[model samples]
Target: MTSRHLLWSALGAAAILILIGGGWLWSLPPAPSVTPPLPIAQAERDATIAALKPPKRQRPLIAIIGINDATETTDYLMPYGILKRADVADVVTLATKPGPVTLFPVLKVEPQATTAEFDAQHPDGADYVIVPAMSRDDDPAALQWIRNQAARGAIVVGVCAGAKVVGDAGLLHGKRATTHWYSVKEIRGKHPTLRYVEDRRFVVDDRVATTTGISASMPISLTLIEAIAGRDKARAVGRDIGLPDWDARHESDEFTFTRPFALTAIGNTAAFWARERLGIELKDGVDEVSLALAADAWSRTYRSRAVTFAATADARQSRGGLRIHPEQVASDWPAERLLPSVADRRPADVLDETLHAITARYGARTTDFVAMQMEYPRNRAAQ
Candidate 1:
């Protein structure tokens, strides 16, 4: 071959090699680049972290037990309302059977779940079980259920006469406990093993806790909330429910009882005409103190024979679960004339305004009667 033909053949061979190398490079999968991208903003990083985080755990579960004709209204409801308001616990009202549990002072409560249904839903049992004061002491099913809950390592709480149920359940044996002052002797006699402690609002022995009176339920519940959700959370809950700086150790005897009774009498008297106008509805209910006051005032009023008093249009239910049926609805009555039940937990300003409004509407005679009733308690306390 000539010199020019040899040079052309060499260029053709070089071109074939370049084509083969390019085909091999194209056949190979692409490799990821190792270079870092632009730095993320701190706010963007935080938002990403928040978005990827797991959800918070659910609140603790609490089960309140009630019985027919035996359960006291306050004992069952106060804690329920308080715990629910706390927003820390999942509180449920349970009973041995379904339907309304007739409470003392003629109130009735329909429990949310039966024992069987509760067990079915929560096979692990409750974290806390509350037993309210019951009139009847011997309920085999209730007693057995209490025992079962205790055996499963759940916290057991008894309020007032509810301590009797715990005692009967055999949980109170060798446990320090207290009950409603009136039932102290009876409870001690019935449960000889129980060491009855007086003057304390509530006593805690291991997982079991017992409180003294119907009203003691509130503080004890706050204590329980403090335990489950920390002191700060409990205090917040207390403040929300109109109790600020609540301490469970504070005994019920610290307050002057006579003043409440006197106020109750006054409230009842004021409610007389309103009751005549509104009528009473026991199914709707009234609190223990309010009910007592109304009853007493009804007995004393001249119109008591002619006019029947009712709690509310729907038969009002009280905080303690007293149900009263009024003969008429108070909706038509003058707003100032309506006797509103003022609980001690109410803010001083709100209470003062409420009192002023009521007295302003009722005239000086009504205010004079209240002042007179109040004076006796002050004098008695001073002495």
Candidate 2:
């Protein structure tokens, strides 16, 4: 063919390809309707709660494990903060190896112990091992440590995509579980023997427990509180945290990559040059749960990423005693870039407020994308 004819043919093929791709994107299912989550049966709740009860001890030992390189902010911190607030367990933050763990979408933290240190201190193993979503699911140190703890009779609780860590450790084989809505398809394909339940924020099968997504951390933490102490104690703690109820109820199907969500993500991500670094000024006694939610939500909005800044480079202790390392000095970012103060706000309220802020800044569709990523039921409350 002549060069002109070849050029024309290539242009026609490109146009056809664009049309086909657009058609498929349009045909993908939209977000599911918002509905009240189906209630978990009382009998099931009782059984599940009972299943997590620790062996007799003065205070049950709980270990929250993460990789030193990177871990999901909310997944690692929320549970630690909540459990410490409850004062029902001896909670220790652990890293796969020594050094501070860099939390994604937000801050960093100095783990109370490394897996090696934990083994030395508590040779008998902890009553519960809390696995947060790490940067990689196949870290050898993490998998082996979890297996050791599980074999030693610890109830393993996997938060969000931490379910994959549990699954990768060969713990969820033939067990019932659930994980982050976005991870379900891939996780299911990887661990085909496990039953992936739906419409549930958390699931428990034998000694292995798994939760839905980042936001599910709050509810799962409360659930663990109940398992360790009692219903009354869990109720009080839940109220203190601004979540009066911590049931395993969730509308999982509602969170998906819809057309609007895709458009917002694509547009926001494509405008990389326009992206901003949003600052969250840190201080001693900051509420870890709220900080996590605020930082996490804002960072997910494609338009910006959250950076924890403080007066000094030293780590500041959160209200519950988790030490958060600041990413930058306060003077590095201008006043307009700092997020509004979230002092005294509960985690759930912080999330709602952040979502509203995201809507105001990037539009409602971007806010929806952030919420969907969290697997949080945002539309119901908004409606």
Model 1 alpha-carbon miss at residue 341, Å: 6.8
Query: Which residue window of length 10 is worst by lDDT in model 1?
Result: 374-383
RMSD (Cα, Å) of candidate 2?
A: 7.3
TM-score of each: 0.59, 0.91
- Name the regions of candidate 1 deviating beyond 4 angstroms: 1-58, 250-338, 341-383
lDDT (Cα, 0-100) at 147 in candidate 2: 99
User: Once model 2 is optimally superposed onto the true structure by TM-score, how far is the C-alpha of residue 62 displaced, in angstroms?
Assistant: 0.6
Which candidate has the top score in TM-score?
2
Cα lDDT of model 1 by residue, 251-286, tens digit: 323222233333333454445466443122233323
Which portions of model 2 show Cα errors greater than 4 Å? 1-22, 33-37, 56-58, 379-383
Q: What is the C-alpha RMSD of each candidate to the true structure, in Å?
A: 34.7, 7.3
Cα lDDT tens digits for candidate 2, 247-329: 88787668775667666666776687989999888889999989999998898877898898988888999998888888987
**Candidate 1, position 338, lDDT:** 44
